[model samples]
Target: MSNITNQSLSEILESINSKKISSLELTQAYIKNIENAKKLNAFVTTTFDQALENAKKFDNKPNNDQLLSGIPLAVKDLFCTENVKTTAGSNILNNFVPSYESTVTKNLWNNGAFLLGKLNCDEFAMGSSNETSFFGNVINPVGDHLVPGGSSGGSSSALAADLTPATIGTDTGGSIRQPASFTGTVGLKPTYGLCSRWGIVAFASSLDQAGPMTKTVNDCSIMLEAMSGFDEKDSTSINKKKESYSKNLKDNIKGLKIGIPKEYRVDNMPKEIDELWEKGKKILKDLGAQLIDISLPHTKYALPTYYIVAPAEASSNLARYDGVRYGYRSQKGKDLIEMYENTRSEGFGDEVKRRILIGTYVLSSGYYDAYYLKAQKVRQLIKKDFDDSFTKVDAILTPSTPSSAFKIGEKTNDPVSMYLNDIFTVPVNLAGLPALSLPAGLDKQGYPLGLQLIGKALDEQKILNIGYAFEKNCGYKNEIKKWWS
Candidate 1:
């Protein structure tokens, strides 16, 4: 039997179909990887026993060509799993297990994908690094104790460290892409409403869309095929007819209209990231793609706007965490108000508290119109920037981050530095566009950096195709990430 550790999902499934391997054996391989790579802290909770039992069922049953059938996947803890403790990397939900499964999870399970575990994440999907989790920091596994970008940090770390072949992550402001850049993997945040947000815990309702994170673009394409589509439960979910992402996987990039966002090359961007961007453009040009200059002039306002809008919405959405309901409750409080305050104070991590404070402040009565309303107008302007840019370019490209992953504690004391991690990705969320981050090159510290492709709204497939094509051209596939070992 082939060792499942190094095998792709498609390869594993093909082996399973031919009786060369059993689902039990395949699941065991990943379970073993999880045990061996314990230092990375990729998962919040595991379900090996449940997975083994399911694999046993698959062994006795029929085999089919389901895309993810028998393939092991770790979901970000943000998604609700029936009866699983989905902490969402927060102590607030430490003992809170959802009685109902999320729509995205149901879709994966229904498609025959195997669940190895629920991975760790930033608290409420708020932070850029996984350090905010109550579960502790997710070590880069790539080398130094660098940050694994978040709130999908565990998802990308799992894939990069070979703990899982693929996993799903939600991106509000580069949660998927930034992590992918940090870990050197392929992560896609589908266009707004392309993937059903139903059942996935919401951070910013309009901005959050779940997508796949995988080691390769092909793996990304395979997983994405199952991750998307419409759901009635989520009113924002688009009812698009599903298409085969693999069909466009091999599309030629010749004459492809790749746009370079002139505004994203902010003066503050590190020179190394600029070099990586240059390399990406050269690779595309070498592949016969014509690079066009595009402008998203409102890009400068994305950070401030996202901070105001997301927090205002989050402050309102997170109000459900009151002590009376689920999550941690304060047993010592004499009154309801005290209970709420005490519980929240103790349950949430520092970052989560900071965001909640910011959110609350923005949404507070006197501040709403000044911060929230103005942010809304800026949000529209950011969206308009993309709308205007698309008229000149087929797809826009930019460095996924200002720089590569930073040391674990380097940015912790400086909240501004931590927030800057999402600088490049924030605009996409503000506009609710599809953006994919793929490993491009390495930085001076030898950490992997990434290049991003922002496609038209509801046009996730094109972004993937562009990433797949560029990945082939750049040929840096595992070079930057392989240093982790």
Candidate 2:
């Protein structure tokens, strides 16, 4: 309770229920934190006054009775927030405020969750480094001049900087986990179709999933409870009975099997990360969980598979913004096609345009079978790697990122190198599995590296149960990441 700025959703709910803090006061505190931490560049737009008004309605609602009641959170700019400027960190939608709210955001609000503002992110959720954002790059709160990763970098940075207790982010290919790894916070990418995709600005429909970024596992569970559900508006939204994400929190992992894919230890991992991975293995082993050396042969092909599949889907999803719709439109043009080229050329960032071109090229008539179809087959093989491994193990354990937070401009110039950062994470997306990034240990530079745990599809609660059990037994304090020093 030192600053209350970084209070978790559960903490806020408990405090509100006890009358130690009111919902309106919590809203004000979060807004003040956002305003004070402007240097973090975590938020693109804030709706403080609007949020304060909403909190008034929750003044007397019992916290235990109302899900997420009195809890304040932020939305990634990629989500359409009604009446709030939903710029996806791109000039393309700079002036576009949505007339409708995204299903995920609306779901959170419907659960009595208070919205703080719109967090910054990569333009169109297209890049690994938030530097692609038109608004500006987000600085890592834990390390000076080090980027907070992307395309959910803003949400992670905001949580790390204590700007917001919880936030929503989309992951197509490790966007959520990589940033969470960089920022030293808990990030969960639940099973695809768990969270509705309606009104979420499309990156890749097949891989796009909305999840929570929080200070701890429990907070993430609470946020997930509020954000996930079935929605007819989103055809992909699974019509499954939603269970309490926190239900399995106290479950013990005494006999659970953890898989270590030797293939995930890439050819050039930093020594510190390798050591950290070994240390993590020892900790889990000592805690009574058995570790097995599982081989995922297709691990090396994850990046190539993700690149083709993500962009191919991206091309189709992004075609809606043809300057004839809601995004930017060129004022002077000879014809419609020229107008689209000029407007899009001026609107999208280098990384986004590059992906679009790559996506379009791979999915084109001549190369569709050679590129897109082949990538799909590779994707199936990657999925099989997990499926086959599950026969031997319950969950897969690996490094969330090959390295910790790199310097701001380090990999921005090389998209291929940047994409490889998701080597250990992409297959999870390709297979539509549930994944989580937990704080592991600090690296050589004092930056934090997180442990990744991926569970079978729709088994997110089990992963949470494992993380919860580990936290209980690992003797891990909620220490601030080393970069803070």
**In model 2, how large is the Cα lDDT of residue 27?**
81
- lDDT of every model, 2 decimals: 0.84, 0.84
- The clash count of every prediction, one per candidate, is 1, 0
TM-score of each: 0.97, 0.96
- What local lDDT score does residue 425 receive in model 1, on the 0 to 100 scale? 95
When summed lDDT is taken over every stretch of 10 residues in candidate 1, the lowest stretch is 476-485
Q: lDDT tens digits, residues 147-179, model 1?
A: 788889888788877788688999998999999
**Candidate 2, 368-467: lDDT as tens digits:** 9999999999989989989999888888788889999889899977888988888888889899999998877777677878889999889888889877
Cα error, candidate 1, residue 293 (Å): 0.8
Candidate 1 vs. true structure, TM-score: 0.97
